[model samples]
Target: MQRFVSERILVQVGLLIVAVALFASTFGQSFSSSDLAQSPMFFPRIILVLWIGLGVISLIQSFKSDEKTRQIASWPRIGIVLVAALIYTNLIGSEGFFIPSVGFAVISLLAFGIRNPILVLLFAVLVPGSLVLLFNHTLGMPLPTSRFSYFF
Candidate 1:
């Protein structure tokens, strides 16, 4: 009964939906037919749609959960991960993508209770490296330029 709703997931989904809707409204305020294909509304429309989908999924899964009891993760751990992510974003432009991203991942993994150094290191490197390659190289989507200019 108590476990029916995954409270944390629900809260996040709701917040995301609200944020997307707000941004979509703000950005789409002046959208018109004459605008180009990649107008301001384009990205907001995509995000809003995805946010709605996520919210719906979260709502359904939470209502349909079959478990009678479950161990909810500690809020402190999630808070730590969120803080680490903020730090990563703040540092990425000044330090570099690799260093800040790896630090963020490692800290997040540790917060989530994965204590193995090898696994943490692997994840820290792999995820950020893949993102850097895919977004920066393959897609040509420029990320924040690392002030140190160490790697692409």
Candidate 2:
């Protein structure tokens, strides 16, 4: 007799609800209905609502189904993905978007098994090149020249 509700799924659903509630409570502090048509809180509140709704759906789905199955999660693979994201975030301020973005992309692809050296090199160049054009030039948020701007 297998349990219908999974402990891990329940915990995750609960955490999601808590996170959504926290976001929702902070909404009133940053935004009011009259602040603007598109206030800062508008997007966050919408996201919070969606998150809570999904959490509820997850809870219901978990309970309504039975016969739980499990698969082994490869921690090394997960760690590699997280490390890539962190590298991108950390280098974004110092190295600018170009180098860090390209490096992160290439490393991420390799972590996921893109073994061909040539293909990995192309991906590294293309990903950051696209980002530079899209965000720096097209979006007008030019990449910072150097850390000297803040260090000084």
Candidate 3:
């Protein structure tokens, strides 16, 4: 019980450190007054601040808690998803968005214990397809494309 609490405390501290680092990284970003609201750094700064605040709160709570609760977390699943995301990031530029994103979605869902093949297939296709359409057409943002670009 004590070991579990200590482990959770370590995780909370790690998260707090990461959040602080992210918040600090945003300080070097410069945004013009005219485009401050539309600046690329604006949203990230906001999110990082919120993340830091949450980390602080969680860290405080972890130290204050007396409950002897044991949490069962799937750390391997997390690792798999992280690795898949890294691969997906690399593939987006080389293999284009559709194939890599579908693969990522499928792998991530499966890693998280989703077993329904039909649902997984639907999500793998629909999510990326919708995002491609929304970003490419509606938002006018161009995504990476391969030789089969015409299909999208």
Candidate 1 stretches with Cα past 4 Å from truth are 1-75, 150-152
In candidate 1, which residue pairs clash? Answer: none
Report the lDDT tens digits of candidate 1 across residue range 19-98.
Answer: 66676576546655536575766666777777777777766776666644456578799789888988888898788777
Best by lDDT: 3
Query: Which tens-of-lDDT digit does each residue in 87-143 have in candidate 2?
Result: 789878877667777788788888888999999999899877777678777999877
Count: clashes, candidate 1? 0
**Per-structure clash totals for the candidates:** 0, 0, 0
The residue pairs that clash in candidate 3, if any, are none
Candidate that would win on TM-score: 3
Note the Cα lDDT for every prediction shown.
Answer: 0.75, 0.74, 0.86
> Which 10 residues in a row give candidate 3 its minimum summed lDDT?
26-35
Q: Model 2 off-target regions past 4 Å? A: 1-10, 13-74, 133-141, 144-152
> lDDT, candidate 3, residue 50?
89
lDDT: the better of candidates 1 and 2: 1
- lDDT order, best first, reads 3, 1, 2
Query: Which structure is stronger by TM-score: 2 or 3?
Result: 3
lDDT of 3 at 123: 99
